[model samples]
Target: MAKKLSIIVVLLALMGATAAAQDAKAVLQAAAKGMGTEALKCITYSGTGGYVGIVGQGYSPGDDWPKVELASFSRTINFDARTMREEQVRRQGNYPSRGGGGIPIQGEQRLINLISGNYAWNLQGTNVNPQPAAAATRQLEIWLDPHGFLKGAMAAKDLVGFERYEGGPSREGGFGEKRNILAYTMGKFRIQGSINNQNEVVRVQTFVPTPLLGDTVEEKTYGGYKQFGGVKFPTNFHHHTNWDHEERPQGYFGVRDGGHNSFGITIANVQPNMCGEAVTVPAAVQNTAVPPVRVESQKLADGVFYLTGGSHHSVAVEFSDFVTVVEAPLDEARSLAVIGEVKKLIPNKRIKYVVNTHHHFDHSGGLRTYVHEGAIPVAHRDLVPYYYYAVMDLAPRTLEPDRLSLYPPDEFQETFVLEGVQNDKYTISDGTRIMDLHLVEGNPHAVGMLMVHLPKEKLLIEADLFNPPAASAPLPTTASAANTSLYNNVQRLKLNVAQIVPIHGRVFPWADFVKIAGSGKTN
Candidate 1:
C-alpha cells in the first residue's frame, strides 16, 4: 500500500467558534462574492502545489517513522466548470515537472489523479458515502455540495455546528472560499473553508477528528482550491497529528502534510495532450545501480555455509543442506529474481524461511510471494497475525501482487508462527546454522522489527539501518532515528558483527557504522 502523508500540516489554521449561527447557503453566497463569477466559472491560476498524509496501520506512538520518506508529489488541474471537462497532469517532486506521465482524472475514475480535481478521494477519510461509481474507473465522481465545501458536509452539519470566520483575500491561494467552521460536539473536528466572490469553493479545511487521542487536542487541517477553469479546490493544506517520541503531558507533534494528491494542468510546456504513449525505457542509460555481486561465502563450522547474495544486503544460510533466505529487499520482482539466483547456487533447496527485517511495505513487499512459495515467514509476533488476517486476507489482485496468493494449508493455524525468542526475540533453525531474530528494543522505525543474526557467519542482517555506502558516498544529512537505534541494539546485544548486510545498500564493514555514529563521518 502507498504511504499516507503525515497529518501535521492539515490543522495549520484554526477557525474560531460561532459558525454555528449561519446556514450553508449564507456561507456560500458570501464566499462567491470574494471570487467573482469569471474566476469561479473559469479559474486559471498555476504555480506549484502538493499534499501529504499518514499511512500504515493505525500509527503507534514511539514506532519508527516511515523509512522511505513520504512521496513529495506535484501536479496541476484544469476544470471547465461549465462543461465539467477536467484535464490534469501529476508529477512527483517538491516542484512540479513535465516529464512524468499523467494519470487521467477526467473521462475515467480508475485514472483518478490524486493531485488534480479528484483529490476529493482524500475525503474517503471522512467516511463519506459511496463515491460516485462508474465503469472502467478512468474518472471519479466528486459530490460537490450545492454550497461548495463537500456534499458530505451537509450530513455532517447535523452532527456538527457551522461557523463562518472573517478573513479577506487569502494568500494560501488566490481570493476564493474563506470562512465557515463546521464544529462538532466531540472536539475541534471542524470544517474551515474559503470561497471566491463567485461562490465557488476555492478551499476547504476538514480538520482531523480530535478526542481520538483522549484529552489531547491534536488537530488536523485540510485545504482545497479552484485551479484552472473554476474548479474550486483545496490547494494548500495540512494536519497536526500527535508524534510518538515525546512524553504524554509534554508531547511533540509531527507535521504529516504537503504532497499533492492530484493535478490537472493546461499549460503547454508542462502537459502534453493524451495520446496512446508508452514510457520509453532509455537505451544505454547510465547504469548507476550496483548489482549485487557475491563477495565471499566461507564455511564457518559444519554444514553452515554463509552464502552472501550479490552486492545488495541479502544473505543465505545453508542449514542441513537446505537454504533459508533472509531479507527480500526492493520489491516482488526483485525478490523473485533473487529467489531464482539463490536456487541456481543451492540447487533444488526449498526456501524454508524468509525472514523479514521490518514492515515498511518496501522491505516486505514480496511477503505474499514468499508465503505462496511456501516459505514460512519468520516475523515479529505482533506482525504475523496482522499479515495473515489483514494483509494476507483479501486479494485485490489487479496488478500482479509480489507473491502468489496461497492461503496456508487447511489445518493451518490462522495465526502463523511468531513468538518472542529472547528479549522480544525469535529464531529459526534447520539443525544447522541457528538464525536468531531479535526485535530492536526502543527503536522508533517499527514497533515489532526484527534484526537477524547469524552466529556462525558472525554477520548481522538488517534493513534500513546503517546501510554502508559502496565507495563512501556522502552520508544522508538526516539518518533515520530508527536505524540509529538498531546500532544501539547491536551494542546492547554485544554480538560480534564482522560484516553488516543492509537490505538496500551494499554490504560493508560493521566498523563503518561505528565511524558514522560515533564521529558523524560519512566517508
Candidate 2:
C-alpha cells in the first residue's frame, strides 16, 4: 500500500508539471504577441530622468536611495550576443554631498557599464576597471526587461504558470486587472514575472542575496507602452531593490515611495536592433580574473591588527578572553577571510562583537558572517530597524541560504542579536583595554556614524570619514564633507589620535589627514 501511494504521488507531480508547462507556453505566447516582441533580437532605449538612486546612499534608513539628475540615460540589450551596455550622464544639480559613492557631483559624470557573456567592466573616460563581481546582476538586468523576460523564459527550465489576484479578490480593494504569473528557473536565478490582462509583461522579479536583507527582493516594473516599429516598448521603467528589507503595506505593485525605489526613467525613444556592433571585451578586462579574498594584516598596536588587502579593510582587536572586529565590509567571502585572519591573529578566542561604523551596505555587508560566528553586532540605535530585525528569518533565504540560516549555533535561540549603541557614547572595556565608540556629530554622510577610539593606544579606527589616498596618488582638489566632519569630530570628542587606522585605505598619520580634510565647515 505504501509503494502504491508513493507511485501515485510521483504520477500526480508529473501530471501537474506537464499541465504547468502547457499553461506557461500559452501565456508566454500571448504576452509575446501582445507586446510585439516575437521577432526582436536587440533593442536600444534612451531617456532623461534623474531618479536614479544609489543603494545604501540614502539620507536615512527608511529614505529612498538618494536620487540625482541623470542628464541622459541610454541602454542597449543584445539578445543574440547576450550583452548589455548602459550609459548615463549624471549631474549634481540639487543633490548634496551627504552620503558616500561620490554623491555630490560638481559637474557632469559620465558612466558606462558594460557586460558581455561572463565579463563585466566599466568605462570612465579612458580608464577601464574590471568589475567581475558585478557580472551576475548586470546580466540579470538584461532579462529583467519586458521583452527579454519572455525570451529568457522561453528557454528556461521548470517553467510554470498560475493566476494571481492583485488584491484580496479579482475586483476587491480597487484592484484593476487580473494578472497571469509565470515562473521559471534560469541558471542559478529563479525568476517570477506577471502579465496583466492587457497581455503586457508588467512585472519581473527575483530574489538576490544581500548582506543587509539576506534574500533581498529585486524587481522591475514597466508600463506606458508605446509602439516603436513592430515592437511595443515601455515608456516608463522603475526598479526596486531590497524591497522587502522592511515590511510593506499590502497593495498591487505601483509607484510608491520607500528606500527600495532604487531607479526610475521615462523613456522618450526606443529603437529595435540598434544595439550597435557587438561590444568587444577589452583585453584589460579579459585578462582580469576574479580576485581571491586576501587579508594583509598590519599590527597597529598591542593586540590591535589592521586587516587590509583590497579596497576595504577591517580591524581585529584582541582581548584576554575574546576578540572584537571593526567594520566587516563587502560580503561573505570578505568576512570569512577576515574571520580566518582574526583566528590566526588571536587564536583560541571567540569573536565577541563586531563594531559597525555605519549602516552603509558596503560597510555592514559582512556583519551577517560574524553573526553566524556568534558575534553580536554593535551599531547605532537608529539602525535597530535596519539591522536588528534584519538578521532574523524574516523572509525565506532559500536563494543562497547563508551558513547562518542553514546551520545556526546550538545556543542560538533565533533572538535578535544586535547590540544597539545609545547616547552618543558606548564603551567596551575589561578594565585594561578600552575602546570608545563616539557618534560623529554634524556629519551628513550617515546619521549614526561611530568612530572607534582606543584612548591608551591613541589610535582611532574610522571609515568614510577620510579614506587616505595612496602615497603615489595625486592629492584631491576639493575637500570632502566626510573629511571635514572627521576633523571637527576628532576635536569635538577631544580624543588624542596619533595614527589613524582607516577602514578604506592604508594607515596614515593624523597630519596627512589634516592636509586632506583641512579645517572648518562646508556650506
Q: Give the number of the best model, judged by TM-score.
A: 2
Which lDDT tens digits does candidate 2 get at residues 215-305?
7778998989989998888899888887643454333123222568777889999998787768999999999999999889988889999
* lDDT (Cα, tens digit) per residue for candidate 1, span 252-368: 223221121222222212221211222121221122223443434444434333444543445667677567777765455556666776676677788888887765545566666
Pick out the ten consecutive residues of candidate 2 with the lowest summed lDDT.
248-257
Clashing residue pairs in all predictions, respectively, total 90, 1
lDDT of each: 0.45, 0.83
Off by over 4 Å in 1: 1-51, 54-74, 77-231, 234-313, 401-403, 406-423, 472-483, 520-523
- Candidate 2 lDDT for residue 6: 100
Q: After superposition, how far is residue 446 of candidate 2 from its true place, in Å?
A: 1.3
RMSD of each candidate relative to the true structure: 16.0, 3.6
Task: Report RMSD for candidate 1.
Answer: 16.0
